[model samples]
Target: MPKAYVFTRYGGPETEAFVDVDRPSPGPGQLLVAVHAAGVNPVDWKQRTGYRRPGESDERVFPVVFGNEVSGVVEDIGDGVEGFAVGDAVFGTALAGGYTEYTLVPAAIAAHKPAELSHTAAATLPVAAATAYDGVRQLDLPSGATLLVTGAGGGVGAAAVQIARAFGLRVVGVASEGKKAFVESLGAEHVASGPGWAERARASAPDAVYDLVGGQVLAEAAELLTDRTKLITAGAPEEEVRRLGGARVARARNAAVLEEVARLVLKGDLDPHLTETFPLDRAGDALRTVEEGHARGKTVIEVTR
Candidate 1:
């Protein structure tokens, strides 16, 4: 039997209960992974708390397994699958069911775990890294362009800072005073502040801005965009992005960009910060970390091994 976290009710993380289940088998084109670690994201908790969109309600329901990113070794390969064999180490997103000892992922979404990253580090990539990559690509900003990222100390913001910098764009990261050092460690010029942060960011760059924070910060940042077309938000305030005539790229696909991100990680160009690790039984504590919105980067649950 394999242990897994299962949510039986829509409430807080406390509502998530750990249970035992038989190991899952891979279906055609699926790979059964012996999960080593699973990344925890805001979406996981949001779903558990019944905060998902109506369209997603059916899929993100109670008794549903939560978790998107997992890093593990392949234990079995279903028929019709090729290019992967037993014992291959890999990481990727499974729309659900990753918070278990075993998970089955479609072959297309799986990638070889970067040689340089541990299972904990690789588990942090799927949702956060993919969101950052897709957001950067959507902007299509030119090299040397000034890009401002909000929530720079958080997972997606941290990833965005590194990705933008790697692409040759100058990055100014906005984070709280406590996280300034962490954000700077990721190669961003850090601006530390609380409310009225946009005004401070304008004082520094006074150029094009990217609103990774969303909500009021997004609304304020949009007003300061040298070119409205240059502003982009990965979260919150979708209407504000539209009102300012800036582009909002939500519905950021997790599976669309993992291959390139994996390549970058493999090449030593991308380093995902896996800041905290919780055991499977402490999954609720992990969700609380994400819910508190103070995580330095990614928080993960070590499922097995």
Candidate 2:
């Protein structure tokens, strides 16, 4: 049996608990990984609340684990799996949850963890950084074009800023005053998020916008773009974005996206900046850090040595 932090049922913190379960073996086209580090994302909490991502099925068994991205060494390989072998270092989105000592990763979504990347850094890529890469590449803003990112202080926002900068796009980032230097470090002009953020972003004259904060923030960011197609959001609902004449950032979740972000990390163009880490027993605290919106860039759980 292996220990895991999980939510017994769909609810809030009350539903989350620590439990033991049989170590999962990889099925066809999957790889079983000895977990080292796992990235904590907002979605982890959302999922605990019974909120499911689009395209995710309703069929799920509970005491579901609490992480999405994980990095570790391969322990076992499933039937038909290729390009991976036991003892190989790897990281990717988990097939179920990541807050455990061992978990299965579908071969199509996992990639080798490069020698240049540590488990902590590799853990951040599959979700936050990958989403940034996908959206920035999807927008494909022209060189010298300006891009605005709301909620620019968080994990996904910071990554978007750096990735957009690496591609030669001018970036304007909106965050709280406390994160000005952090956001600026990513090569984006920092705009304080508050009453007049829309005006501040307007001053930057963005040609495109990436909204990482939903609700009013998404609506406000919508004001900065004349071309709705040039506006995209990772935080808002499809109806909300559609009402504003824009669309959500369509994600291409695969090994290719993970590999691209890893390349960015190795090139020194993308740093996940994991500011905090918790051990397996304190996995709840790691999730709480991101859930409380107190984390700067990324938070992770170190599940093993």
Write down the lDDT of every candidate, Cα atoms only.
0.80, 0.91
Worst 10 residues of 2 by lDDT: 51-60
Q: TM-scores across all candidates?
A: 0.89, 0.98
- Candidate 1, which segments miss by more than 4 Å at Cα? 53-61, 206-208, 237-240, 250-256
lDDT of each residue in 163-219, candidate 2, tens digit only:
999999999999999999999988999999999889877878889989899899999
lDDT by residue (tens digit), candidate 1, 1-305? 78888888887756778888778878998899999999988777776776653245355445778888899999999999888899999988774588898999888788877666788888888778888888888888889988888888888888898998889888899999999889888888888757777677776663456566667777777767768887877666456677877866554443447768877777766788778899988887887898898688989999746
Whole-model alpha-carbon lDDT for candidate 2? 0.91
Local lDDT at 61 for model 2 = 91
Q: Name the top lDDT candidate.
A: 2
Stretches off by above 4 angstroms in model 2 are none
